[model samples]
Target: MATLRKRNGRWQVQVRRQGFPIQSRSFRSKADANEWARLIERQQDRQELGPDRKALKSITLAHLVARYRDEIVPQKRGSAVETILLNRFLRYPICQKTLNDLTTADFAAYRDQRLKEPKHRSDKPVTPKSLKRELSPLSHMFRHAVVEWEIPLRNPLDGLKLRVVDNKRERRLLVGELDRLLESTKKGRNKLVAPIILFALETAMRRGEILTIQFRHVDFGRLSLVIPESKSGYSRVIPLTRRAVAILEALRLEDAKPTDLAFPITPIALRLQWDRLTARAGIDGLNFHDLRHEAISRLFELGLTVPEVASISGHRTLAQLMRYSHANQETVRTKLQGPETGESSHH
Candidate 1:
């Protein structure tokens, strides 16, 4: 409906309709006001140039998330992680609201509230890194809705700069820390943790990639393993070190099929086991991902080139690969001595 009123000596026209955002404009004359209102209403009636509130009102954010989780997420390499994130998103208060009622403020509020709370019962508040992952699915879902599903609503997450991305972790294993962590893992019921941790440091493979390994992918003859599906959405063949090959050999079962997953634990169980092992080891400020950083740093220290490290780690960009290549002072000191001639070690 269009209402015309004379305010401040100019005719003001306001268009109000259900399932449409309220729009107002001022015109010099009532004739012009009527014409503009007619055009806007007609255009809106034909469903042009605005979000479709009717469709949005009927579809809740939760519904959209469910659809995206079911239809789109399954095709991705990180489907399990994304599916978990989407389900966690569905429990948010804003998900109960229809897309018509959701504004950018809703998402902003969620970020603030979510950041204040500790996720998964940890004492520390949610880090920007984890929050980025939580919001990633929503960002992609909104884009898919707009482009593929023909949903007329603009993404609320767009322009909301809640995430400070890529907070690089420089945590590396301290002197004798690897041995201590392995000893602690030996006490745990998950017997594979020690070897898995060893394999992780040796190969620089992500936890997901490590967990999904099949027997057929490991070539005992070549001393290499193929990560058929890496986190980068591509298959990469990383040459296993002698230690990594030995770990695989110890874990390989005679009766196991080629299709069996090397590590039968779910990601959640692995996380829980890691937490326990870390606590038992008296380690602080360590994460499972840090092993990859340690591995990549070791690879660089071993005189491997950037391209060589990227091939093993499956990092698509140099920036990302460089993030994990933090070299320590000890490494630099060792390198400056010219191939362990014992010149710098005399101190």
Candidate 2:
């Protein structure tokens, strides 16, 4: 479409087309301006003008997500889970919007709608924590597109406010639960699960971090293990208990090279075996991650300070570490009555 007008003694013409930015030109003669308008309109219709706008207008968020999944996700540490999140995101209605049409309001609506629904294939409610996890890879996708791929747009999630959520699980191992759990894994041909369970309880390392440890990262002379790569993307040395050291010494293969993973099992295999072991042990409502929480809390009970435990647990903030570390009533009462305490009276 073309609009003609006279401005300041110049014949001005503006041409508009669907899926393309409106363009205009001015000329001394109406004939010259009209010719220019027709040429621009033809170029716009053919998608031959304003390549950036044309590309933006043609592609949808779903397409970019697919590209990101294939090209980017494989390089990430959490690719398995992140791939699933991006694949599920591709099916969302918001993905149908073109780049030019995308806005924060679209994702705001998506965030609310997802929160109201049950989790996929389960009766559990969709939690804000789970939503935040899903959004993590999606958020990085936008950043990579803009910063690396030069997509010419701000991240839509930049200003979106997520609901406050506290999904911390304080479900520590109950009395005798660890023994039963250990005993159950003994029947399996794969012997590493028991020691892995012990190691997690001992060091508070995440499953991913535990699996990635190489024999070279251990310093037996110092009785400390170096987490070469952590979730925080830095190395930290965690002081080892005698029991933790003994567990590692037993597991170390005499023929093992420094680069070989200490625990040879894959993450998927570990997860499947964990579920089976817990069921066989008759342990209810216990997650593998709960071991890390138990370890952190026990460190505090042993009188380790906040910074000390945080370094071992890879927690960047004190508040984050505390959320995972919970003390039971009996434990708190015992601490109050310890020999170091002074006599107390009602205030």
Candidate 3:
């Protein structure tokens, strides 16, 4: 079950547990070597080592990230976001490290290094909000590591505090910005992005959901689209507004097959086009996700209740939904005026 042998003038633990290659470093003391072999053998006897560290220590973070990207993230609506973060943030730094070598200090160092990087090869500093978003997936991965893989003792993220992200809610178009953006979308080389932008603003759906939508998922009669796998693994049916329906109707591909994707663009391509659109629109520091915020704010301005907004946005909690409904100081004063004057029933 366990064997200790002399190698390079030191005793090494060598054990083959149920076809696994269990080999460890050569220890200077024979007693230390024997104890490690015995403990591992006992864990093997209990069927714990075989399922836990047998392959986990050998598995590199790159390997696990690839598996996670293909097997897990594909099933969620946030796949595109996760993919971007993995590629730009986690993948390069940790890919070479084994799972066992991922210490909290290493993660902290990554966070610090990311924060210090000039944004997008420019001299601009990386924001705390962006850094927080990058760290979000790692927390989930470590959770999966502990619960699913049975990695023993301590989550790397247990006590670490991430900076609070201060998000500026994008409410609506400012003056002629929307018209300019629409014109740019139509005349620009990336024409396919127009319908996607329209759909995102109308439905309040994420970019990933828009990219992966299939014709079969649309229910024309019910005026709703079903997302079978969302970020939360909870399937949801989102009711389409008239504008959304119109956009979809115009987007219907000529000679389209039933199985065809609504938009035939990859996530990376869509983002590239979005970058062009934003650059043309003269918008700065706004992401594709800000469009969702714009839509939710529009919903609130249209006098939709919180539940009504949440139904379309897929916000699981009230707190999540509230983050999108930011009213300007002028609007807040106007909204408070009627109540202060005792002239309105609605508060």
lDDT of each: 0.85, 0.84, 0.74
What is the C-alpha lDDT profile of model 2 across 1-347, one tens digit per residue?
A: 89999999999898765445668888999999989998986665454675356768777998999999999999989788788788888888999999878889999999999989897545778888889888988888888876577565557898899976676678888999999998898888789999999999999999999998888998887999998788889888889989888988898878978888889888878988888898789988898999988998888888778898888898988778767445645677876878663756656
Error of model 1, residue 190, in angstroms: 1.6
> Which ten-residue region of model 3 has the weakest summed lDDT?
45-54
The residue-level lDDT of candidate 2 at 335 comes to 64
* Per-residue lDDT over 1-347 for candidate 1, one digit per residue giving the tens place of the 0 to 100 score: 89999989999999976656778999999999999999998877556868656768899999999999999999987688789888888888888999989999998899889899986847889977778878888998998887677676777888787657765788889998898899998799988898889889999989988988988999989988887776656887888889888888788789989888887888878999999998999999899999998988888888788899898989888988766555744776766866655456555
> Which candidate gets the maximum TM-score versus the true structure?
1
RMSD of 2: 7.6
TM-scores of the candidates are 0.78, 0.73, 0.68
**Clashes per model (N, Cα, C within 3 A):** 0, 0, 0
Q: Which residue runs of candidate 1 sit more than 4 Å off their true CA positions?
A: 1-48, 163-165, 324-347
> Quick one: best lDDT, which candidate?
1
How well is each residue in 1-347 modelled by candidate 3, as lDDT tens digits?
57778978998777765324455657999999888888776765544643444455787777766766667777765677788777765446656777667677777777677778898635887877877777777677766655565444245666666676675565466677667778889767766788888888899898778877888898877889988777666878999988888877777878877678888898888877877887878876667887888888888878788898888888889988767556444566787765575466677
